[model samples]
Target: MSLGAEETHHGSLKPHDSLFRDAEKVSHSTHRGSQVSWMQTLSLAFQSIGIIYGDIGTSPLYVYSSTFPDGIKNNDDLLGVLSLILYTLVLIPMFKYVFIVLYANDNGDGGTFALYSLISRYAKIRMIPDQSAEDAAVSNYHIEAPNSQLARAQWVKQKLESSNVAKIMLFTLTILGTSMVIGDGSLTPAISVLSAVSGIREKAPSLTQSQVVLISVAVLFVLFSVQRFGTDKVGYTFAPVISVWFMMIAGIGMYNLVIHDIGVLRAFNPMYIVQYFARKGKDGWVSLGGIVLCVTGTEGMFADLGHFNIRAVQISFNGILFPSVALCYIGQAAYLTKFPENVADTFYKSIPAPLFWPTFIIAILAAIIASQAMLSGAFAILSKAQSLGCMPRVRVIHTSHKYEGQVYIPEVNLVMGLASIIVTVAFKTTNDIGNAYGICVVTTFSITTHLMTVVMLLIWKKHVIFIMMFYVVFGSVEVIYLSSILSKFTQGGYLPLAFALVVMSLMVTWHYVQVKRYWYELDHIVHIDEMTALLENNDVRRIPGVGLLYTELVQGIPPIFPRLINKIPLVHSIFMFMSIKHLPISRVVPEERFLFGRVGRKEHRMFRCVARYGYSDTLEDPKEFAAFLVDRLKMFIQEDSEVTAQNEPAERDNSSKEVPEAQARLTQTTVEEEKQLIDREVQRGMVYLMGEANVTAKAKSSVLKKIVVNYVYTFLRKNLTEGHKALAIPKDQLLKVGITYEI
Candidate 1:
């Protein structure tokens, strides 16, 4: 547990120091202020309707049409399909996500990576060893539990951490889940918009299929073009449109029930679902691929939890969205019972003659909003993966100053927009797009089910029986839906899998190289004692200005630093080893962001600073960071002086005791002198020194490893954003030391 004299001096203070206690009080109050008021929660809930429910809300437009691709068999078939839709909406989105999975979030952030982060914090299953002791002290990194309650969780954690296979399997599941979500991001917009645009033919019978496809493509272009405005503006603008769309669907559904057969309400009974499958055995199973579309955006509810709180998402879904969607489905079934032939266009046909055009316009608008949910979720998952070092560094723009989680990645948006347009042009029909979209949704859901089971046993500390029940019920439903969709792999269903495999491969390759590079650095780290000896050599000369060597190592001098000194024999008068660490939480408070310590001793003029950030925190400009580091360095000097004075031995004789005024004056002068020295070095200039590592496979490695390292990883490194660029470091003041690694 000991980190030597360097860490002992800088990382802690004397028990009697009032300054340390006061800082702790401020950090606690800042965290307490983060809780939202009930009124604010309601406001957020209203906005969440536009951002979170868009995909699932628009499902009624094509559910019946997609479900009965070959046309409705009979009146009983209509009731059976409706029953299946009703229970799917209840079990998946309602009981499973809103009640269970949402609670597993890592400090309010959601999705597959967030769940993985939460589990990793409670155990040591993380594949990389980048975490330091200082990281565990973050305000939100909670891993506390009574021994009696944590027995099972501890056992599970030990098993996972002890076995390399288990660790890789867990990480693979997390990455695969993320890939599927990104696939959903592309597929949702295609299916949702195409289904809505298909309604145009109902009013204008002269329109050809190609014309409809072109119109859909144009709408998609406009949708992605406005994404730079950020989620707050988009949510505010789209909320009213979506709110009206939900009300219109619910009203039209009730109208259909009153005018058509109300007896279709009997589909609410679970018996109808059983009977539907019993009458048409193989055909009923295949219909599930279509019926699952009712809950297409269910994963979005959890994935988008980062933009809003759990309460807001829960309220929006259960209070408004859940009832409206259920009613819309039942109304469509009622109309189909009377006019079985109209099942091909149930949503548009069920509308009354006078309200048809207005309803049609709102459905189109609502469909665009639905695509936003998954697109936003896609950005969130990618951001999390990049922070955890599982993805290549890309440009991440923090779109909202007020909301930390609202982000926009231009590269991802551009690629996603193009991919979606291509799919719309190629498939060109709702049924074909539906085949691709269903698989992505169910595969993501199944991955979440498995991850959540581990979370229940470990983080949540639930009983084994509860875990089994959760897995069996949810797992069984997802497996059945997955099988039905996999059967259609030859017919458009392969699209998501193809997309997921490419994405998953990139993630795995990037993560593998990063881990190897980290081990290379760790193995060659220079100890404090060795660094001190190097400084004492006559060939080395200490220069006047400050040097901040950027590294990933927190505990010792990076190997590149020693190499720099040996090659050029020049060192800074004041040197700082700087490292930036991204924790699994959502945000780290400014007061707790930096941990500073002396490298060897006060006379060595060397220091170490570990800057910790939450995944959601933005990196400040390099100049601003330099100024902040100077201020913290000054503060550390004063605190260290105070601690030294307290630890000094008392005078044995009364006559030998120092005067109170003289002692106080002496202490103040010493602290001021040290502060001024640091300020003078700052005025001279500060330079950022970083290492440029070239990674390749070992000479005797396998052919596959060589391809991954020499080709795939090198290409990614050259094309993606570098570490310094991502941190906004100025080129003129930056210095790069080259290091080659054959891993």
Candidate 2:
């Protein structure tokens, strides 16, 4: 496929040149080292897919057995189930995922961050677009910052950039995705293990039930132990493993249909659904209790978007997975109808006892793989979230390809591990746990459809009518699924539902707290046009000297403009500047570095400046980024220091000069020396806000003690990780409110 002039090919060398920075000593940055082979790349992708698809694959263990009303509905109803399966695997995964989601990847990175990066490039990023930057650039005519395609794109993409609005939206989506997934992750293993163990009982009619329990425990333990290996290996085998699974099911289903002959054809008819519902009425609505179980893994498919190319997943579905599932359901229906008295355990009894144990083992293997898929995807997503600051960073090891995001989290493993074990012990088997699985899966699937709806409308700009048509179809299917799953509420289903609710709540709360803290930090650095004027009019303290602050986000303007204006407008007097460079997540690759752009402007002397980063930086220190600005800033205009040997600045107002000659200087100093210097006054800005305390803000606030708090809070929020939240929890218990005022 051809790419646009502005769009680089997916395999283009030095892809991040237009972006901010290359990876900087990041744990798993792929751009840092030796080039990998195509085979290696394929391996990585496959592993990622495996880790992510585990839950979806194992759904067959219950979906076919559970989708219809008890005692066989016939051919017609079976066809509908088959149709749904076909469309789900073939159409949805193909169109929405393979064609769209995978193509939407930003620099090979997927998830909200990939979308955020792409959109951030084009969205308008300033708090407001029209402001003071034009004159300032005009004044510092020699300070060459261009309005390049990259610069314009950054603002254009600001709709979901690194801002409060974007973070919140992403957080909401992640919570929805993770909650349902965690719900399934906890239950899939138990069901798979239990199902496998129970099959052994059929072979040895008198086999002690204790053996089943022992087998389950042993298998679960082994599954848990192998998690660190990642999903790649299992992912390769998934297509094949699941291929056997479907074949076995289809063979059984087809055999049953043949035995039942003409009567079996009735099962393929839709009338069975209508007639069954007509007679059962409320009872059929109640039978819907099981119909939803058929689609338990849909949401997990969405959550695993980053793990596999949409095409691969869709191919797996349409080419093979869906047909087998349909056959299995139809077969189950035929067998039950042919011999009504033998409805119970029909899926197993129809087959030989020898085959039952093997099927059980295969099913269990499929389950462990499903669980691994979820586990790894979670690790990857959380890793990206940490770097993006949606969540605090945790210690993560890369167990797969060095994508920086293909991570291993011991803590996450432990938590999920312990919880899954507890749940398995509580529920005991697949039949018991199946109820909870569908509820979480369907609920999350419904939410993904909603998110996909938004993506189509805003991002893709699809027509409203077209979007709605798809929405209605998908939504109806989900509603049907959801209604049936609701029956699970009375069963073990409440566990996953409650688990989802709790996980979502915590994710939302953390996002809220992150936003609040961001606002407080903004209060420290910003100066509003109106508020600063009012302060100046009222004889408020004069902010001294031009102060510049370095910020983490690479954008047109800081997101917390309101808090910035509210807290610091009158606190300083000099031309204040806030600067951020677009930093990429990969290592420096040379051709992509060295940027020049100006995005936003406020009244007085405050200006927004951005610089893009090059790729070779994985080995280089990023602080040198600020140093680069200082070097380039020297060309802004003849330095006032050069113009007036003694007191040039007193009369040389910035209005006369084209650009404020930011005096940021970088000196090569040892860590202890740099720390000591910052200990006195940490460097406040990237270009010239060198040193700790903002000399301007400090002079403005003579109270002294107040400045200390601001500095401390800034220091901690930037440096602290999520693990620190546990420390703050105790303080919150002692105090009714959250940790708003950092000591």
Candidate 3:
């Protein structure tokens, strides 16, 4: 059976009073959207142009120049390349992405991790065993299919879950895809800004390459520096700039078509693409490395979908962005047909004399917008990775209260900005940067295609024949593009590959150590019986006030609690084992935030509380969290008393005996009495008890494991944000206990 089906059956069999069931009543709702008003959709569509289409929109500035770096041999070559560009834009971005891939979003979040999250919900394919039945219920994970399709999905799930190699392969592909996008985060700014700035030399021939590079770097600095203002502000500001840019390009394209070769429109025929490849032979095939640049920002379209709705992205791309970009390419092709020798500067040369200056300025602005899209996408994917435990904790600032998906990561911005500047300075020309940029773009595309193929079978439950067709049609095209780019690896293409390697390594290492640490804690968890025995000991005194013990475990006492008791021989009069879990959805509702259950006997005064949050949910401060916890605890106690009172008469009749005074007192406890007791504990104040695990490799481990765990994981954990700080726990009320683990 599929993972969701299995979980549903298991959950149905659970007792009504099961803790997981209690949490289910308050679980976060599904991320499905209601129908949007047309006006709001249009506004979002307008904003999407600046954030979603910027990278691909700016492609016309460099595609022709990059494609024919050796200069066009004839009009056939121009028409042929134009045909290739047209088909790629239509097939990949329009059909494959806009229509197909966007629908695969995990609760409105996109990108590779989002895809993985969706699949993991349907299958037990995640390597980490942190997911629970409660998580599935809250995440709104489900599927409805005919028996035939359901069997196919179940088969896919069983095969994936059974094979460790398959799971690793899937995760590795996701990490690789994410790494490439982050790599693109730096490369996009470098190429887009440099290409835009290089246009200055067309009118001002005296400007040196160094001067252009300096100017581009300066623009990049300003663009990234302003990211802290968030996507809402940036989108509003950039929408007008990009909208004007599209209009200008479309207007100029029409003017060029009228004045030059209107026949260039015939390049839309697929026959030209075949003919171009046949005539140019190997050279034409290799030119794909340049031709693929037309869809550079296509991944950004899906990646940034979280910033807006899928409908808005579709409206923006199809209604305004696609037609303008296509016309711009056609116009450039027409210009190149007349002046084949001007292939090196087709974008600028094609511009009419009067509109040249204005187009140049807009190109620079649009280029910055393109970079902004990729940078924002990078921040988004990294945030998802961290929440899933694949990446180290980084400070994630949710910029828009209305749009939780819109975020800014200060560390990521600074790193990408510096990387962009370094690359612009080093490459010194758009030609070299284009080589590197094309690899990052196509590699990401190929990864997405592969992941989507799996989604079609396991999640979409498509018939095998249709699934094969989707893969063959899209995968074949991406493979051709991938080959062309890999051929140019030595020609600066290695830049992104090297960067991806570093990033992927960091992510893989971090995930590995985190899983180990979790397993260690799970193996050592303190059972309720053990906890009850420990509390009954005379030496272990229950001190006054409440203590919130933080742990990764969702059930039972944390291993650290027993260790703390052993070391100090003291416990709080009222203690809570608090586990914070990040679900794989976008946001958890505040009403369903905390799941409370008694840990043991009534007089033990101990409880287990799980604070569940979605990936995009913001954590509350310590004081607010304490208030919510106390309020929830009081309700839980009063409900427990009511249940006990109802059962007491049944027990009296069955046994023909009087209840003990202690038992009667517990059953008779009123809501007001419970409230007063909780308030009294609250007035005494709460302490946040957290554990700091120091991990090291066992002596028997291999050299590689030792190096990875001891050095890499240690360095990352030490540098990244601590759990307490990320959760906004107050330092004064926090007590951290250190525990050493050999893994």
Q: Whose TM-score is higher: candidate 1's or candidate 2's? A: 1
lDDT of 2 by residue, 1-743 (tens): 00100111111112222121222222232221125555554544444344444455555555545544264545444444443454455445455555555544433345444444333333432222211221111111111112233433334245455576764564466556666665665666666566556666666768655667667777777777777776554446865675676677677668766876436444444555566565556655655545555555544454454444444445555555556666666566566555644443555666645576677777676766666656666665555444333344355566655433345766666666766677667765555567776676667656656655654544555555777877897788678767766766776767877887776655544444444444444444333334335445654454443334444323323334333444444334333233323232322233223323322221233333433321111212344544553443332212222322233345556575532333322121222342343223223322233112111123444454344335433444455443323212222222111223221
Mark the regions of model 1 whose C-alpha exceeds 4 Å error after superposition: 1-23, 26-37, 143-148, 645-655, 659-668
Candidate 1: pairs in clash: 54-370, 55-370
Off by over 4 Å in 2: 1-54, 64-171, 205-214, 231-239, 259-271, 300-308, 339-346, 402-405, 526-743
Question: What's the distance in Å from true for residue 390, model 1?
Answer: 0.7
Top candidate by lDDT: 1
Give per-residue lDDT, candidate 2, residue 350: 60
lDDT of 3 at 68: 88
Clash count, predicted structure 1: 2
Q: Rate the local accuracy (lDDT) of all candidates.
A: 0.82, 0.48, 0.81
- Which candidate do you rate higher for lDDT, 1 or 3? 1
- For model 2, what is the error of residue 739's alpha carbon versus the real structure, in angstroms, after optimal superposition? 13
lDDT of 3 by residue, 1-743 (tens): 01111111111211224344444566444333336678888888887887778889999988988898888878888889999999999999999999999988766777888788777777777766767665555534453443357777888899999999988988999999988888899999899988898899988999998999999889988888888988675456788999999999998888888889999988988999889988999999889999999999898878777667778888898999889999999988888888999888788888999999999989988888888778878887787777778887777888877666668988788878888899999989888889999988888888888889888888788889988988899989889998998888888889999999999899999999988988887787666668778898999998888988898876656678888998888888788888787776666666556666666766677777778886656778677888887887776676656555665655444454455555667556555665787688878878899888899999999999999999999998898888787778888999989898899
State the weakest 10-residue window (summed lDDT) of model 3: 1-10
